[model samples]
Target: MSDDDGLMLNFAIPDNGTTTTANTQSKNVKVRGGRWKDRRILKLELEGRPKEKKVKGPNSIPIDASRKRRMEEKPSKPKSSQSNPTSEFKRAKFTETKGEHGGKNDSYVSSLFTNNTASTQEVPEESKEETKTYLPSNAPDKNATSFAGLGINEKLSKHLTDHQRFKYPTKIQKLVIPNLLVTERDLFVKAQTGSGKTMAFILPIFHKLMMEYKHKIGRESGLFAIILTPTRELANQIYSVLENLNRCYPFLVPGIVIGGEKKKSEKARLRKGVNILVATPGRLADHLENTKTLDISQLRYLVLDEGDKLVELGFEETISKITKIIDDNSKIDETKDKWQGLPTRRINILCSATLQNNVKQLGNIILNNPEMISVDREVEGTILFDDDTTGEVQTNNEHESFAPDQLIQSVLIVPPKLRLVTLDASLVNIANKIEQSGESSRSIVFFSCSDSVNYHFDVFTRDGKKFKKVKDEETGETKTILVSPDDSADEDQDDAELTSPIINKNTIIYKLHGSLSQQTRTTILQQFIKDDPKFPHKVLFCTDVASRGLDLPNISNVIEYDAPFTIDDHLHRIGRSARVGAKGNATLFLLPGLEEGYIDAKLKIVHPREENLRVTKYETILSSAFGEKNSTTKNKFDKLGNWDIHATTWHLEVERWLLENSSALAKASHAFTSHIRAYATHLSQERNFFNVKLLHLGHLAKSFGLRETPKNLGKKSSKNNDKFEELENGGKKYKKEDPRKKMLRLAKLAVNSTSEYNY
Candidate 1:
């Protein structure tokens, strides 16, 4: 009837059923005065059906005697209407059996009609099955547009395109660019390494620079951006990235300031004005101290890359100093009036892979209320890279697939006297294994300490010696080659000299450690990464410093000559080889009881392994030098098993004693006396003496009186007020000395000391 009330209907009938009426209204004609009345009426009826039917009686009711007899013989059903048919049913005729049948059929047909209409008028399948779409809580809304999509200003886009990053924005960039483009707020971002974090802040700084350029804000007085990193290499890396951007853009200039490089040249670059400056905190501070004219008053953006490592490497003090000089709230602002009157207008950005406590504290001091964007934690181990051209993807290699299942991690438990020889032999065995496996050129050897790094480097290089031809006096520039160990001579003579060619040619070795100059370190690392096929096999002797932050693409085997201090460190060492879907092999050499001690100590730090790793015992090259039947061999093996237990017990006892008697030994003099008393007691018991001798007492006193004695007084005594005087004196003496020289000296001293000390 109306649009809202409109309803469609349909009907169906059984094939066996007879249709009643085609049009009910046509039969509703009413007669008035022998003619159809002029009024509309409706009626319902069955078509061509008789109103009534009746059956004729059999002739004379079969009154014959035979008919009556046959009827009587058949069983007859009882008929009752209170034992008799009602006279009212015949009179009314409406209670007939035909009427009852019609009523029941009408009710059944009505239900069938209703069901057929409902079935025919059902909604379409596609319309009924439609569903609403759901999106993740953290994902950007579908309707929202990103900074890049919103017609980013030409200058900003130009800078981004120059860096070859003109595609979609990273999560951090998408969240930060809008806020930074309008406001100057310090941001502290905690993100994984390879998450495009560098470009997040860099893009915004470029945008600000472009805006300033468009507005014709004349040349700024100081650097606009200052980026600090923990190491020289990282600073250089950032510098390289920015330099590439400059090369592509042609208008921007970037400067790098780091240690182990020229300062005057860096200062010269700064005087010329740079849009961005990347530097190590220490070197940058040094430059700031030396060059008063190189002001950073115009510094707008500050970025700390790898902030976790900056704190780890103890650069917090330097970072604080640098920040204090730049920030408007710093006490150093008293000297600001000496420079330009421009306001600081600074915003700090911190990026780190992991947020250590110290790093968080530092960020709290530097950044304002910050927004946090974290990629799923589970997906962190999965490294994702997009192809610039084809947009293909890749994933990291799982450790299980890369490492061999049957490769045993064993420790060659050698006595302290033979530890060096054991290490040497282990290196040789690893080299041989790599060569035999046909992958020696892709193997790496890890050493614990720098000294060991140099030692193994020398040994391996010597073992794989190559000689060049030289002119002989008799032969005048003839090409006569000199063989290693003088192999051209007798065997005894060859062996007598510390020279051998057989051990040399099979392996090429390189050394790596923190102490090496950055140039040397990078060169050696690059060479290792580019291990030539002609060489077939090369060995890398490195300290733990090389274990992390390096992507060695072709390392097939990793030899842990010295066991790692913790399981995480061990995993990181082995992780170097088996990366980005490559199979790798790892072997460890544990000197007998060394495994137990490391395992016990390691469990206190990292998650403990459910079961101990499989370890195999190898015959010590040193132990075999003696006769196999010697009692010394048996005694040595027995001692090796008990060494860890004895050492642990002794360490625990010492720790307990220090904790209990620390207050009594607060004074340096008192701590020294205690050390003497302990040593005297040990000597007395060992010598079976009832009392200490004057000579022994004198020796103990002298040992305790040495300058190095205070370090042996344990943590508490070293941390006490008495040691403060020694620290202060040392600091003041080196206050005027070169900080680098002092740092080197202190590092060396720390390395050499076997005892724990505060300073």
Candidate 2:
């Protein structure tokens, strides 16, 4: 297959379930990262890793943070004889956190913008309008025959077309796969979430493992490929993908060993000698310590899925221990008494949706002569600052194919006070639609925490005896029930009007959170993924645990019941539905009504969003009935029962807020805060350091939609034609005065020219 760019693909692969042997006799065949560049990979011959005694098992791994040595800041001024003034580049020093860890004080807490009342600022006409999207690349080609065209083995290509049915390769897949086969470089892949990144690394690693195994250079076998991810669910998902592909090459056995699963079972699987192991770091380390059958000394390929998340301090110790154990022992022994040793050489692939600086640092530690490939622009390890003019917003690479083209963004006005009741309404409607269509509906509702998830689950499953609504068998009448979102156990059983809730049919809801046992979560995921027409878990309420790496198929809608805290979270949460070139819908519910605090919350969401995502927009669907200060929502009482005056009022208030503030609310995360966390309050200790704040007046202006106002020239968006819009009388150009000239004219040479402060 060839694209319009004239890029031809090679699909010839093995049809028989047979492994190809590597020709060891071939002389110095070109390898990618194996033939390392001096500058790309730092030589450790004279900088050997600190020597340590051999760790017999995982039990020997230390949990303590590895001590990091800091290079002291140079003295302010070196003596004249020792000073050098000609250095071309300078580096900044790391900040010191030595004394801040123990201090707990209320001095830093401030209600930066806790507005108690409503305030409105008229936005400029130009500012009120949205910007036009810029497409820099030609449209994607969907006419490709199969994955084989992208250089896959023929059998694999046929399976892709006949089984997986992926007719074309994604942008990252096209860029990554070809390079992996042709070049022998360490891989650092940063594709957007849901971009089929798992395959990008898996295929290459599988191919290499097969080739290397055929040549027989490494030891007669243990696991050849080890995929380490952060969470259990993610590990399972990666394992599933690997298992599916392994069917073609029946010789390869893939297994998963994640936390919370039985270690005995894991050992049993390992005892059988699996060809590939997908695991979470903690458990893998544990088995490595206690289990006698586990061995990875001959490991050929090491893949870090969601590499950015796993490279953090929390998992750093475990990862370092694992890598050290797998590192060649002979090379280390050669330099045990000296500071010289050979670098550990192995195939390393690090993958993530967002590659921050810390993740880059991790690549330096493990990868040699790595090729850094991303589907989008750069992301960060640290926060961007208001004064950092060098920083740029996340841009869409016109060529990137990971972003779902048909993803539509929508917002449903909802109040925190009536969140559950409103959720019930949404679910009831969704179920009705699914029944009418005779197809299963797949929707994920994201919450802020596990507590919220549990609370909502109870409400959904609760059979009302007290707070539950009662229905008349003959008249078909029902009663409104009000249950606290936080405490679903509260019910007024004594009320004669309140009756047991009629069973809601076709409402097969599943809950996923960190608190759920690994086995239970796995079961729930299985039921949810069940595509059988008979019964399926349709609705899933979860936290961020399900956001990053889990790929649930046929997810048609992603609903955020609670607003996301961070911009990246928002992107990943919605990414659940619009995956693998499929169109999907996302609806976010905003909780804060029309108030200043609400706008402040909106600012927190928007700033981060503007930094990394630009091509998407949220449709403000708030109707006048859902307005502010009105706590009542229709709450679909007509469907369940007569709505409580208060619940109905609150529900309407949510709509009113959205309707009244549509201009601000439509910006999605950038324009609102719908959910509030307890830790966000000033009374919370941990809230002090991470609370969002406006850095400067210009930042505040930008957040409030005044970024393009005449005076705030510090920031500008291409679509803000402020000057053009402000033109009066035939679009005549106004002679603008330079501030520098104005300052000079107003100052009148303040001091005597000869006696100025400067020499």
Q: Which candidate number maximizes TM-score?
A: 2
Model 1 per-residue lDDT tens digits across residues 427-496: 5455555556775446677765654455344333443443345688896876735366434435442111
The parts of candidate 2 lying over 4 Å away from their true place are 1-141, 211-220, 329-344, 377-405, 412-415, 464-504, 532-537, 593-759
> Whole-model lDDT, candidate 2?
0.52
Q: What TM-score does candidate 1 get on C-alpha atoms?
A: 0.46
For candidate 1, the 10 contiguous residues with the lowest summed lDDT are 109-118
Q: After superposition, which runs of candidate 1 have C-alpha atoms over 4 Å from their true positions?
A: 1-222, 328-345, 376-444, 463-507, 536-538, 544-560, 563-749, 752-759
**Mind giving the per-residue lDDT tens digits that candidate 2 earns over 1-759?**
334446443323323454433422222222232224421232221123223333221113333323211213434655342242211112122121223221122111111122211113211222456543333111234764346766777877677667874667777777777777666567777777777788877886666554544343222346667899887788888888877887777666788888787778888889888878898888888877788787775566788887766764257778877887778422433332322111234568888766555565566556665666765543212111222264332222221223444565555433233344455555555665566677776889887656456545544553432234558789999964445333344443111111113213445567787766676677778867877564332678787788878889888878877656544566678778767766676766643333224324433343233312221111111111121233356332221221233234333333333335553233322221211221132122222322323113232222222212124221211122334323322566435566334322222221111111010
What's the residue-level lDDT of 430 in candidate 2? 60
Task: List per-prediction Cα lDDT, in the order shown.
Answer: 0.48, 0.52
